[model samples]
Target chain A: MSERVVAAAEEGQVVELRRSGRRPRAVANGVRAAAILVALVVLAVFPLVFSNPAVTTIAFFTLVFMTSTTAWNGFAGYSGYIPLGHAVFFGTGAYTLAIVAQDLHMPGGYGVFWLVPLAGAAALVVAIPFGLIALRTRRHTFVVITIAIFFIFQLLSFNLGITQGSSGIQTPTPPWFGGAFNIPFYYVGAVILVLSIAVSWFIRRSRFGLQTLAIRDDEDRARGLGVQVGRVKLVGYVISAIPVGMVGALYAYFIGQIFPQSAFDPLFDITIALMAFLGGLGTVSGPLLGALVLEPLQQYFTVSDPSYYLIAYGALFLIVILALPRGVVPTVGAWIGNRRARRAAPSPAAAGEASGGAPGGTRYAATVRSGE
Target chain B: MALLEMEDVRKSFGGLQALSACSLEVEEGSIAGLIGPNGSGKTTLFNIVTGYERIREGAVRFRGTAITNSTPERVFALGIGRTFQLTRIFTRLSVVENMLVATQRHEGWLRSVLRPAGSASEHRRAMELLDFVGIARLADAPAGTLSYGQRKLLDLACVLVADPSVILLDEPAGGINPTLIGLLAQRIRELNRQGKTFLIVEHNMEFVMSLCHRVTVMDFGKTIVSGPPDVVRSDRRVLDAYLGTEEADGDEAP
Candidate 1:
C-alpha cells in the first residue's frame, strides 16, 4: 500500500511536468493576442500621429490593397484558382459608384457612403455571370478565362459613352483639404479592411471554407466525398467580390477621377495575387501582412521613380520566389509549427520538416499547393 | 436484394472500350468482392456508379431508386460513399477534420457557414470512428504525415463518417502491408457485422477469398465468373483468365 502511494506520487509529478511543458506555448498564444491588441490600437490612431497628407495618402492605399488582397484570398486562395483578371469586378464597382452618384446628382459627402454598399452589391451581381463562365474551366484555363473576361470589360469601358469613352469620370472633390482631407479616406479604408478581415475570418472557420479547402487540395476527391464544388466556388467568388467592390468605390472617390484603363488596370490582378503570394496564400492573416509590408514601399517607389518602379518590384518578386518560395508568413508559420512539434514531441521527422521549409507550411498554405 | 446495381453498364474512352456491357450487383447486407486484372474497368464501373463519368448506355439503381446520371454529391447524399484507389485524403487537414468533411453533405453551404463547425455529438462520432480504425492517437496530426498504409486507413475512416448504407472501396488493400491489411479486414468484418454493406475492388486474391461472402471476377471489361469464394478458387475459367491460357510450364493463377 505504501509502495502504490509512492508510485501514484511519481505519476503525478510526470503529469505535472507535461502540463508545465504546455504552459509556455499557452503563454506564447497570450503574447500573440496582446501583440494584436497593441497593433489595433496603433492603427486606430495612425492618421492623428502622422498628420502629413502624403503619409495619410500612402496609408489609405495600403489599407485599400490590404482589403482587396484579403478579398481575393477569400476565393482564389481557397479555391486554388489564380485569377489574372479580378480588375473586372473592381472596375464594375468603380463604375457603379460613379453612375449612381451621377444619376441622383446627390452632392457627394457622407451621403455617398450610403451608396458604397450599393456599389458592392452591384459588383456582386456582375460576378455571377463572370463566375458561371469562368468556373467551368480548371486551373490554368480558369486563369486564362479570367484574363479574357477582364479584357472584354476593359474594351467595353473604352467604348461605352456613359464611361466617357477614352476620357474619364471625375468625382466631386471633397470640400476638405490637406491632412484633414485624407483622414476620412484613411479611416474608411481601415473600416472596410477590418470588415473584410472579419468576413474572411468567419469563412476560415466555417464549413464552407473546409469544403473549399478540400476542393483546392483535390477537387475530384472532394467531389467523390459529396462536396458541391462548383457551388462552393461560386459562393466564394461572390463573398470575395463584396469587399473588393467597396474598396473600388472608395478608390474612385479618393482619386476624384476614374479612367477605363486605370479602373480596369490589368496590374490590379497581378498586384493583389503578388501580395497574397508574398505573405502566404489562403491564410486569414497572410494577405493583410503582405499588403501592409509591400504597399507603402510600392507607393513610395511610384512617387519617387514612376518609370523604374515596376522593374524594382519585378526583381523583388523574383528574389521572394527563390528565397521563400511559400512566402514569408507561411515559412515563419512552419518554423513556429516545427518548434511547437519539437516541444510537444521530440520526433525525428519534425526536424526534417523544419529544414525542408515547404510542405505543411500551414493548414491553409498546404491546400494551395502547386496547381495542375 | 441489391443495394447498389450497375446494370449493363457500358463506357468507352476514345477508341478504347473500357467497359463493354459490364454489370455488377452488390447485395444489401454482404461484403461483396470484385477482383480483376489491371485496366479491366473495375475502377471505371466505380466512377459510373458514383456519377463522376456519365454513362453512355446504362442505368444505376440504389435501393430501388433510379439514379442514372445523378451527380456525385447526389449519389453520396442518397447513401453511398467511396474512396479513391490512390487514397485521396486531404493532406493539409487534420485527420479528424478529414472525417468531419464527410458529414457535410446533409447541410447546405449557407446553413453550414452560419453554424458552428462540428456539434458535440458529431465530434464524438468522428473520434469513435477514428478509434474504431485505430487512428485516434493521430487525430490531431495532419493527414499528410500518415504512412501509405495509414493513409488508406484514414480514407476508410473518412468514408465511414457518413455511415452510408453502401460503401465502395477501390483497392482497400492494394499496397499496404500484411499487418494493416489484417487490421483493415478486421475492421471491415466488425462493420459488416453491424449490417453495413461493402463493395470492394481488390487485387489481393487471398484477402478476397478469405473475407468476401461472394466474389465476382472480371477480365477485359466483362464478368467471367462470380460465386462463392471456394467455387471461384476451383473454377477453370478463373485460371484461364488469370494465366492467359491453360499452361503446363510452371504457371499459376494470380
Candidate 2:
C-alpha cells in the first residue's frame, strides 16, 4: 500500500500531497489576492461594528499608529535602511498641518484632511537632502543620523514658537466632522489606515519593490547590476515619510493639540519599529499583524497597569527578537510550510522521489552536482 | 584604436600600493584574459576600470570617453556590466525578478507608481535571457535556492540583460564544478560570437587558454606579460610567475 501511494505521488496522480489542482505559482498568487481582499473588507466594516464613542476613539488612534508603522516598515523592513528618527517626518507633517490650521486658520478639516498630505509632501522635499547625506553612511550610522534629525527638529519646534513653542498649538476640529472627538473621525482614520496599507502593498509588488529587495539583500551587487541604489532608497524613504506625516496630522486633529515632545516622541518611533520587527520585517502583512497584536496589549497596559506596561513591551520585544529573529509571520509561515511538506509525505524515500519529479527537481539535481 | 584603455592607473590603500601604475588595453569585441597569482592586483585593476576603486594618478578611457572616477551606476549606464567572483544574487527574489532588475527601464518613483501591473515585454525578455543561460526551468525559483553553478549562470544572465558592450567577469569558473565549467566556456564563446567584448579574470589555465584570444598577466601590481595564448604559455616570465623557481624546474623537466 505504501509503495502504491509512493508510486502514485511520484507519478503526480491521486495523492494527498497535492494541495490543489492549480499550479503552485497560481496558488501562491491567489493566497496573496485573497489576503488583500479580506483586509479591505475588514477595514470597511470596522467602524460600523464598533459604535461606542470610546471604542471609536481608540480605533482612530490605532489607525494612525498603523499608518505610521506601515510606512516605517517600507524602509526598515523592505529596504533594510533603519530610520531610527522617523518621528521627524511624523512631526513635520503634524506641525505643518498644525501651524496652517491653528495659526494661519486654514479651514478646519482642510488642515487635518488636506494639509496633512501636503505636510507629507513637505516631508518628501526634506527627505531628498536628508537622504543624500543619510544614505551615504552605513546602516548604523544612518540610524544615528536619523535620530539626530529627530532631536534637531524637536528642538527647533520648541524654540521657534511657530508650533506654539513648548506648549504646542491647539488645532481646531472641522465643523463638518462634528468636532475632533466623534465616531465619524473613526471612519476617516480607517480610510487613512486602509490607504496606507494599500499603497504599501502596491509598492511591495511593483518594479521598485523588486529593486528595493535587491538593494536590501546586497547594495553593491544591485548597483553593479545597474540598479540606482541611492535614488531607489531615497524614494523609498520619501514614500515612507508621507504616511507617517499624515498620521501625525490626524493625531493632532483627533486630540485638538500638538506638543513638540508629543509630536517628536521617541516612544512612537520605537513602537513602530518594534511592531514591524515583531510582525515580520519583510512581509506585507507584518506591520498590520504587529499593530493588531501589540496595540491591544498597549491599551490594556495603559488602562490596567501603566507603569508595568513599558517594561512588559520592552521585554516582549527582546523575547521575540531572541526567539524568532525572522519576525512572527515568516517564522510561522516557514513552520506551516515545513509542516505541510512533512505531513504530506508518508516516508522519506517516497517524498524524495516525489520531489525529484517536481518542477524544482532538475534544479535540485543541478545543485547536488554543483555541491560535489 | 583600443576600445578600452587604462593608462598607468595607480591606486593605494593607505600604506599598501594595491595597483602600481597598472595599465592594459582591451580591443573591441575581443576576449581578454587577466591572470595573476593571489594578491597580484588583477582585481584592483578590474576595480579601477569598473569604477569600484578610484585611480589616483591615471586615466581610464572607454571608447575614447574618459570614465575615471565615475560612479558605478554611471559606468553601468555607459554599457559596462560586471559579475563578482562569488556570485551576488538577490537571494529572496525569483530568478526572473533578478533578470528583470538588470533590464533598463524608466525606474523613477513616479514611473514606478504609474507603471502597469504586469510587464509582458520585461517578463518575456527575462525569460529569453534565462533560456539563453539554460535556467528557464528555474525562472520562478528563488535565487537563494539555486546551486552555485546555477547562480553563476544567473549572474551571467543578469549581466547579459543589461545589454552591455563590455562585460567584466571576475573568475567565472572559480569554484564551479567541471561540468559547469564546460558550460561556461561554451556560453562565453557563444556570447563572444555575438560581438560582446569580455575582460575575464580567471586562474584556470586550461579554461582561460581555451576561451581567451589574448592574455594579460599581472604580478606585484604591474603587467608581467601580454600576448596571445601560445606566446604567453611559452614566455619564461609567465612560467616563473605562475610556477616559481622550483615548479618552473619541474615544468622544464617535463
Instruction: Highest DockQ: give the candidate number.
Output: 1
Model 1 Cα lDDT, one tens digit per residue, B131-230: 8987776676567756687788889988889888899999999898888799899999999999999999999988898899999888898888889999
- The per-residue C-alpha lDDT of model 1 at residue A262 equals 87
- Writing each residue's lDDT as its tens digit, candidate 2 over B1-254 gives 78889888888889998888778899999999999898989888878777788866999999998999987877888889999888999877768888988775335556765564338987888888888887886675567667677888899999998789999999999888897799889988988999999999999999999899999999878887999999999998887887787765887896
Chain A of candidate 1 compared with the true chain A, TM-score: 0.87
- Per-model DockQ: 0.47, 0.42
Candidate 1 achieves a global lDDT of: 0.81
Clashing pairs in 2: none
Point to the candidate with the largest lDDT: 1
**Candidate 2 A-chain TM-score:** 0.84
lDDT of 2 at B41: 91
Compose the digit string of candidate 2's lDDT tens values, residues A278-368.
Answer: 9888666777788887887788789888999899988988998899776777766655444455465668787776653443433322221
**Distance from true position, residue A284, model 2, in Å?**
1.5
